[model samples]
Target: MRITADRTRCVGSGLCAERLPDVFDQDDDALVLLCADEVPAGLRQDVEEAVQRCPTEALSLDADAPEH
Candidate 1:
């Protein structure tokens, strides 16, 4: 799956980073940043949880997209 973040909608709640630090992080301004554009096979579940738990709905996954 491919993960994408909408920075404009991020509230910097840190939930995404807290749920999956390997794939999400907070910038100096406390905005959400994607650590990896492509989700790692082992971290798909964590990514999904992060997306689901994102209060602002800023995190999204494109499961049907072709892998690069």
Candidate 2:
């Protein structure tokens, strides 16, 4: 799976970063920042949870998506 974050849509709630700091973070402006686009096999479930918890729905998981 691949993780994607839309900063423009982010509310900077820090839920993703708080839940899974390994994959998500906050920029200086407190917007969502993706630590990595590629999701490790073990972290997929946690990442999904984080995405779902995002209040702004700015985070997403794309299964088997091609690299940009």
- Report how far off residue 35 is in candidate 2 (Å): 0.7
- The segments of candidate 2 whose C-alpha lies over 4 angstroms from its true place after superposition are none
lDDT of 1 by residue, 5-65 (tens): 9999999999988888889999998899998999988988888888999999999999899
Assess every candidate by TM-score.
Answer: 0.91, 0.90
lDDT of 2 at 33: 86
Residue-level lDDT for 23 in candidate 2: 90
**Model 1 — TM-score against the truth?**
0.91
Residues 1-68 of candidate 2 have per-residue lDDT tens digits of 78899899998899999888889989998998888888876987898888888998999888869766
Worst 10 residues of 1 by lDDT: 40-49
Q: Which numbered prediction scores highest in lDDT against the true structure?
A: 1
Worst 10-residue lDDT window for candidate 2 reads 59-68
